[model samples]
Target: MTTAIDSLLQILDLETLEHNLFRGRSPQVGWQRVFGGQVIGQALVAASRTVVEDRQVHSLHGYFMRPGDPSVPIIYEVDRIRDGGSFTTRRVVAVQHGQAIFSMSASFKVPEEGFDHQIGMPEVPMPEDLPSEKEMAARMPDTVPENIRKYWERERPIELRPVDLTHYFSSKALPPKQYVWVRASSALPDDPRIHQCVLAYASDMTLLDTSMFPHGKSVFLPEIQAASLDHAMWFHRPFRADEWLLYAEDSPSAYGALGMNRGLLYNRDGVLVASTAQEGLIRRKKPRE
Candidate 1:
């Protein structure tokens, strides 16, 4: 049986349609729209294929222009922006039905020694101490919402172990910060580029919801509509996506139907690997008249 992780790898393996063009398809998982992380990962793969192997992606900025159409294929068009001595840049546009769904700019750099200093990773319970989804369900069978439980019952490419479950069981307002340990559900190849793509795919998980924390709300709330608007990431160090990594995230503010969130990813050894920032739509939907 093809595992979910296997399916993810297959989707990331884009079909090269023509020079500077690639085609990617979404997993037919019954989602009304394509997942944002999938697009980011696929677009990065499309860009990475055009860059020299020695050059690794150091930063990427993307914007979602429209909801992706999962029923059809997404065409990725890569623009060879520049190839400097130490840095290479590319711009990618994801198109569906001849309309642009997302656009991104990525920069790749040849590994070089540099002055490096990073803040300390927060002290939190490691994955070993945290319970798995099945355990969580068993421990709090009565509290887990049916929709949320159904979502977790499905096979996933990434496994998440959140540090806190209070918010799920209670609607009380809480701090805007959250910590989650995440990794690919299964072992992955040794290729650094694939690891980067897989990490990119996982970045979109359990984020944006940080913004709703202060409002005593969650993305799962029926009245709330959530969507990623823009995303930016800076890769600081090499890390394997198959190993546990801490995703420490916080939301600074939310206003006028928008929420801003930031996350710092650290490997099990506490090395900061990547930092990401995203702004999302968090508007409440109109009630039926």
Candidate 2:
């Protein structure tokens, strides 16, 4: 298996050092701190392990308590909050340096017959027409600003093809909604759980940035600061993370140093597998001359 695929699988193997205590390592070559996606992904895996096969994860809500240390392995403690007939709930606390760096609550639902209807997928160019974010980053010379380059370098495992690259950094105003094609660079394991959690991990990246386009601000620009405060996702259908998925995101509001963004995940077949919403810290700093 390729290294990216291997990382997806290795992430599932939570080290069982003690009862109710699971250890997780970092996927290095990224930020100074642990990637938010890694903690979110690993926490979902930890929660899923404690639930029965019949009950599958349907929704998850998480909060970033503190910055995670990439140098230290995270210890997850799963609390079996409730196990009933129709629904089961699990709480996972990710700790590093003896402090809770992240916490998540996942609810699993037993399969049942239900009526369903969803909005159709938006029409967009195929992933083939867009250049991968990696390719774009490679074109940047060493002269590129460290803050801007680090934003691109820290990204791996998943591939991103923005619909409008210039809009991401341009000083001009743009639309509130943005579309990007995303998928795992390498194929994931056959296990359905791994694919779902990996999708959850990758979902956190760039979706919130869609909101900033309208304001002509980006983390790449010196005047803005961005961070995810909380994230929530709901699984709607089954899909593969290795295959292309259209991530259509939009931000309806940005005020009080925060931005609200929502996105829908659509597979190449146009199946809507998931929906996500997040509110993030969108603080503005003084622009440098």
Winning candidate number (TM-score): 1
Top-scoring candidate (lDDT): 1
Give a tens-digit lDDT track for model 2, residues 1-289: 3476577668667998776679999866555788788888999999988888777789999999899888879999999999998999999999988899999999999888899889999999889987666566677645455665555665368888877776644567788888889998887777878888999899998877877888777756657777788999999888889999999999999889889999999998888999999998888886678
Give RMSD to native, each candidate.
0.7, 2.6
Q: Give the clashing pairs for model 1.
A: none
Worst 10 residues of 1 by lDDT: 146-155
Cα-based lDDT at residue 127, candidate 2: 93
Model 2 earns a TM-score of: 0.91
Off by over 4 Å in 2: 137-155, 286-289
lDDT of 2 at 21: 76
- Give candidate 1's error at residue 67 in angstroms: 0.8
lDDT (C-alpha, whole model) for all candidates:
0.95, 0.84
